[model samples]
Target: MTSTDAVPTTAPAPTEAPSSGIPDLWFELPPGFLEFDLEEDSEERMVRMADAVDPLFADATPEQKLSLVVSGEYILQTMIAGGAEHVSACLLRMSDGKLSQATLCVIIERPDVGPESQDRRGTARRTAVQWHEQHPDAEVALIMLPYGPSALCIRDQGLQLPGVLFGLDDPIPTTIRQVQFCVPLRTGPGSALFLFMTEDIEHWAEYLDVVSGIMKSVSADEPDGDSKPAADNPDAGGTESQA
Candidate 1:
């Protein structure tokens, strides 16, 4: 239940490694994006949530506070269930009480091969092809990010029930647009970062660019004192995302 700071337009600088031995991943998020760590325990998570929304609940009734806490827990659990290591959300108020939102989920994985030996272009192409197979209508492309070769996929995800997060009893279904990026990490063998962003279809283009900038800002510190931006080599051959 520690005090939380205001949401930053960019991520903070990397700190020392955690006690769990996992190195902190560094990345920036656009303005209005609030990020939550999905790896914390329930009590810690709840405390973090309370800290973030303290101003909103400062003068609210007990019942209202409970409802808000419950809704927040539900959203956290859903993200944890989906294997997200971290989640960030940007919500904009729209006319007629509607909301335009962009959500980003980060998932990290370690593979068998190291970054030096991995085939970046082939990896990017394979990822694109796999996603294309699963979503025939998706627009898949290989992109060269500052970090390295990466895959980008964009597609309409039909209707989704996001109202649950807002505590709506009978929320309307809204169409979702998704943009996913798979970028190989400089961290040893097959370490990669996956960014999955979902947004309201009406604001897909704007949000996609925001997420892309976020992706470009991602970097990791290596064990041998090397930095991600300088350690990994970027390929210039891949096509860029249309956004």
Candidate 2:
């Protein structure tokens, strides 16, 4: 995808209604990603996570559990503060037995005007142009997805969160690179869904491919009970879920 070129496309397909209230769309995420339930309160979410990870932490001491829960709470608070409708973490075990992880956040946006007031394709093109104008160095391209047109932006140097988020006292902040795709949804006028992923630069290439595959798998309709998770499909990269 070039900086200013629109990738070739096939005809657009019809939009699907969101299965849930907050997220008007559904997509998938690769294995190792633990999706947080945004509707639940922090305490409830913590309990959920604890239960999910109980097997792994079955032998943990009281102090270890306390420290881990505190850290988890901080991360959850930050994600909620950023208006993330869907939040997930991809944790992998490195060769040396160390843990490596990345994060993906999805935020759904609704148009302010009436549905008839805006054109989906036009809005996507405008978004691409505006992003280029604001960040000339960042790579921007207009691409066609199965559902419709979208604006994809890649920035090597992305947002840096404060150290406090990780319970660090150092003045240096944590740096992360981001790949974002703004997909215009047909659900409403000027409505769009943004998929933002942040990861270490070393794993950028691998994660980019993963995110691209996830974007390609996005659909308006939720998957039926018979549908297989991405893990079961060798060609697919993520598990179907509402976001």
Candidate 3:
């Protein structure tokens, strides 16, 4: 395995808006948070990225192409916070000034492909195992989220923060590949997973608390007769939910 302090390069603007089912649109940014405007065609950018790395897609076996179908069809918008610069749609800093770094990446999976929640966990474990086999020196684990409903927690050995998976729809053939590649980035600290975070070992607890707040803010359903506005929802930082 190789490591580089390089940043992500920007891709051409996309022509279409990515589709998502999450209702809450607005989100409150933590202090020092930086927002990025994603160009359209996130999936296209990812395909191009894979080609750059492998280059022989046309001649690869069918299974190889399927494995490469990690990003699915839609990449969705992203909200990044912490001490780092944004590069293109899928890249970020390897490490942030010794401070913690976290990103909320929204992904859409069709109801057709992959396993459901319980099965998804098994798949995640397999992915982690494969990752370790490739990079033996790298640390990896398949843990459960501390709070919220039972969900698989994917984290690197020393990463203070781990990305969470929030599956909005039922498993379908179209969305089956969503689990193929959870994170958009193929290298660096955050890869093939959502909610990537890297921080000092001692700050792990602090980072978990911060990420929890962000997840609490996410709600796909309209605030029912009992629900409160997103901003009121501490997780959302007081922002409206977008359709």
Q: Please give the CA lDDT of all the candidate structures.
A: 0.58, 0.58, 0.32
lDDT of 2 by residue, 112-192 (tens): 676555566677888899989988988999988765678888876534444563567754344567777787664555444
Query: Predicted candidate 1: what Cα RMSD to the true structure?
Result: 6.8
When sorted by TM-score, best at the front, the candidate numbers are 2, 1, 3
Q: lDDT score, residue 234, model 2?
A: 24
Model 1: ten consecutive residues of lowest lDDT: 234-243
How many residue pairs collide in each prediction? 3, 1, 22
For 1-243, candidate 1 gives per-residue lDDT tens digits of 011233446444232232435554466666656677656788887777666655633544554444445544665577678666667655433333333445667666556554576665777788889988999998988887765678888887655445655667776465557788877544443435455544356655556666767776665644344543323455322332211
How much lDDT does candidate 3 score? 0.32
Between candidates 2 and 3, name the one with more favorable lDDT.
Answer: 2
Measured on C-alpha atoms, candidate 1 has an lDDT of 0.58
TM-score each candidate.
0.66, 0.68, 0.33
